[model samples]
Target: MNKYGRQSGPRYSASTNSAKAPATQQCQKCLEFGHYTYECKAERVYKARPTRTQQLKKPLKRVEVEVPEEFLPKREGLAAKILKDKEAERKKNKDKKKKRSRRRYSTACTHMQAELRYFIAVVVQQWKQQEQQEQQRIFTQLLFRILALSLRLSFSFAFALLLEVVVRIPFSLLLEISVALSLVQKQEQKCEQR
Candidate 1:
């Protein structure tokens, strides 16, 4: 059995064309309850219904009338008044332009001042860099001069030590001192090269 086809209950047969029961008001024609005035079996009164007014798609054309010159509105001084207003506006615009020029000059001066500060900063930075390079060069020269002086002193001292060993000490000790001096000189040379 299909559930949607029919339910297991009593069926109802409703008529779409059947008239509905009237309201519980007495009819004006028959003075009866549950009946409308129009459905009464009496002389039917015919009353005219108010009809709706239709609006025109296009409006009616306007009629033009000729107006006399002296009786019409005056426009004699309109151009003069407009010219005066325009002159006043032009004066105001001129004043505004002068103010704008002054403002532009002030802003330009401020921009130039900023650029000048930046230029001075760059110059100072370059000067510092040059000074640092010069200091580094002077230090390197001083270090080289000191290294050469130390090598000369070491050679003269080794010669003096070798002479003292040969004159007052053993030959074996002299040989050891000479060998150590040669090694020291070679190491100093390497350091100088670096």
Candidate 2:
């Protein structure tokens, strides 16, 4: 009996008789039309299960086999050719490094030259400013010296004029005293003769 408690037999429907053409039958076990499920030819393939012998079988292990030197492929001059190629690559890398270094050196030189020019220009400007300050200092000192000399000359001339006035006053008083004495003497002699 099947799982549904039905006998394992062919089932027919009313539609099978009404159809003029014969209907194709399919087997549930093998999924093929034309035969019933119990009469399927692929029953052994679908119902067969693995035995303990098959389950216990181990997988195959790989074995290494040595090849003879005579059977190996030949590479006669390949090592020399590889050496030459490596040398060429090394030379190319060295040339590239040299070019890069040359470019860097030229750029650094130009940068240094520009910095030197700028430094010189700044120094020159500072020197000119310092020279101008020195000249101004010298001119100021000369002007002060001339002004001091003129003041000294004016003070000396005023002092000389004051000394001449003081000396003339004393001399004039002495002359007046001498003239009055002479007049008094002449009056005394005339009184005695009388």
Query: Which of the numbered candidates is closest to the native, going by highest lDDT?
Result: 1
lDDT of 2 by residue, 1-194 (tens): 79989866446465653434214877777767766665566853466756778756854576989999999887668898999999999999999998997677567646644553443344344444654656444433432332232222233332333233223233543454245334434543553353
**Tens-digit lDDT string for candidate 1 (21-107):** 457767786566776665577665566644444235445578999899989977759788999999999999999998997677567
| Model 2 lDDT on a 0 to 1 scale | 0.50
TM-score of candidate 1 on Cα atoms, chains taken together: 0.25
lDDT of 1 at 160: 44
Against the true structure, whose TM-score is highest? 2
> Model 2 segments beyond 4 Å from truth?
1-76, 131-194
Clash count for candidate 1 is: 0
Clashes of each: 0, 0
TM-score of model 2 (CA atoms): 0.28
